[model samples]
Target: MESDLLIPLIWTVVFGILLTLGVRKFTKKQPTNKRWVRPKSTDEINKSQDE
Candidate 1:
Protein backbone atom coordinates (compact mmCIF):
# COMPACT_ATOMS: atom_id res chain seq x y z
CA MET A 1 0.00 0.00 0.00
CA GLU A 2 1.00 3.64 -0.28
CA SER A 3 1.33 3.94 3.50
CA ASP A 4 3.85 1.12 3.67
CA LEU A 5 6.00 2.72 0.99
CA LEU A 6 5.75 6.09 2.69
CA ILE A 7 6.90 4.70 6.02
CA PRO A 8 10.04 3.15 4.52
CA LEU A 9 10.78 6.28 2.56
CA ILE A 10 10.55 8.39 5.67
CA TRP A 11 12.80 6.03 7.58
CA THR A 12 15.34 6.02 4.75
CA VAL A 13 15.49 9.81 4.81
CA VAL A 14 15.89 9.86 8.59
CA PHE A 15 18.66 7.25 8.45
CA GLY A 16 20.49 9.18 5.74
CA ILE A 17 20.42 12.41 7.78
CA LEU A 18 21.62 10.60 10.92
CA LEU A 19 24.45 8.93 9.02
CA THR A 20 25.58 12.21 7.51
CA LEU A 21 25.63 13.92 10.91
CA GLY A 22 27.46 10.98 12.53
CA VAL A 23 30.15 10.97 9.85
CA ARG A 24 30.61 14.69 10.14
CA LYS A 25 31.03 14.37 13.91
CA PHE A 26 33.59 11.57 13.53
CA THR A 27 35.84 13.55 11.14
CA LYS A 28 38.62 15.93 12.13
CA LYS A 29 37.78 19.42 13.39
CA GLN A 30 40.61 21.21 11.63
CA PRO A 31 39.87 23.68 8.87
CA THR A 32 40.80 22.60 5.31
CA ASN A 33 43.53 25.05 4.25
CA LYS A 34 44.92 23.08 1.30
CA ARG A 35 42.37 24.38 -1.16
CA TRP A 36 42.74 28.00 -0.20
CA VAL A 37 45.51 30.54 -0.75
CA ARG A 38 46.02 33.87 1.03
CA PRO A 39 44.83 36.88 -0.88
CA LYS A 40 47.33 39.60 -1.79
CA SER A 41 47.15 42.93 -0.02
CA THR A 42 46.87 46.19 -1.97
CA ASP A 43 50.61 46.76 -1.82
CA GLU A 44 51.32 43.32 -3.13
CA ILE A 45 48.79 43.79 -5.89
CA ASN A 46 50.29 47.10 -6.94
CA LYS A 47 53.77 45.64 -6.87
CA SER A 48 52.74 42.74 -9.02
CA GLN A 49 51.00 45.03 -11.45
CA ASP A 50 54.07 47.26 -11.65
CA GLU A 51 56.31 44.35 -12.58
Candidate 2:
Protein backbone atom coordinates (compact mmCIF):
# COMPACT_ATOMS: atom_id res chain seq x y z
CA MET A 1 0.00 0.00 0.00
CA GLU A 2 2.80 2.41 0.85
CA SER A 3 4.53 1.57 -2.43
CA ASP A 4 1.38 2.38 -4.38
CA LEU A 5 1.06 5.76 -2.66
CA LEU A 6 4.77 6.42 -3.25
CA ILE A 7 4.51 5.65 -6.94
CA PRO A 8 1.72 8.18 -7.48
CA LEU A 9 3.50 10.78 -5.40
CA ILE A 10 6.69 10.37 -7.46
CA TRP A 11 4.72 10.62 -10.69
CA THR A 12 2.95 13.74 -9.47
CA VAL A 13 6.26 15.40 -8.67
CA VAL A 14 7.72 14.43 -12.03
CA PHE A 15 4.66 15.71 -13.90
CA GLY A 16 4.69 18.95 -11.97
CA ILE A 17 8.37 19.55 -12.79
CA LEU A 18 7.84 18.74 -16.47
CA LEU A 19 4.83 21.05 -16.67
CA THR A 20 6.74 23.90 -15.04
CA LEU A 21 9.68 23.45 -17.39
CA GLY A 22 7.43 23.27 -20.45
CA VAL A 23 5.56 26.41 -19.46
CA ARG A 24 8.78 28.28 -18.82
CA LYS A 25 10.27 27.11 -22.12
CA PHE A 26 7.23 28.25 -24.14
CA THR A 27 6.28 31.42 -22.20
CA LYS A 28 9.80 32.85 -22.07
CA LYS A 29 10.27 36.50 -23.01
CA GLN A 30 11.86 36.99 -26.43
CA PRO A 31 14.31 39.77 -27.06
CA THR A 32 12.87 42.39 -29.41
CA ASN A 33 16.25 43.60 -30.70
CA LYS A 34 18.96 41.12 -31.56
CA ARG A 35 21.68 43.62 -32.40
CA TRP A 36 24.30 44.49 -29.82
CA VAL A 37 24.39 48.29 -30.09
CA ARG A 38 26.40 50.72 -28.08
CA PRO A 39 24.79 52.80 -25.36
CA LYS A 40 23.78 56.37 -26.18
CA SER A 41 25.84 59.13 -24.72
CA THR A 42 24.67 62.24 -22.87
CA ASP A 43 25.48 64.33 -25.93
CA GLU A 44 23.23 62.14 -28.02
CA ILE A 45 20.47 62.52 -25.47
CA ASN A 46 20.89 66.32 -25.48
CA LYS A 47 20.92 66.48 -29.27
CA SER A 48 17.70 64.47 -29.47
CA GLN A 49 16.15 66.71 -26.85
CA ASP A 50 17.09 69.86 -28.81
CA GLU A 51 15.69 68.37 -32.00
Q: Rate the local accuracy (lDDT) of all candidates.
A: 0.91, 0.95
- TM-score, structure 2 vs. true: 0.58
User: Runs in model 1 with CA error above 4 Å?
Assistant: 31-51
Model 2, 8-50: lDDT tens digits are: 9999999999999999999999878779889999999999999
Worst 10 residues of 2 by lDDT: 30-39
Clashes of each: 0, 0
lDDT string for model 1 (1-51, tens) is: 699799999999999999999999999598766877788899999999999
Estimated TM-score for each candidate: 0.53, 0.58
What's the true lDDT of residue 9 in model 2? 94
Lowest-scoring 10 consecutive residues by lDDT in candidate 1?
28-37
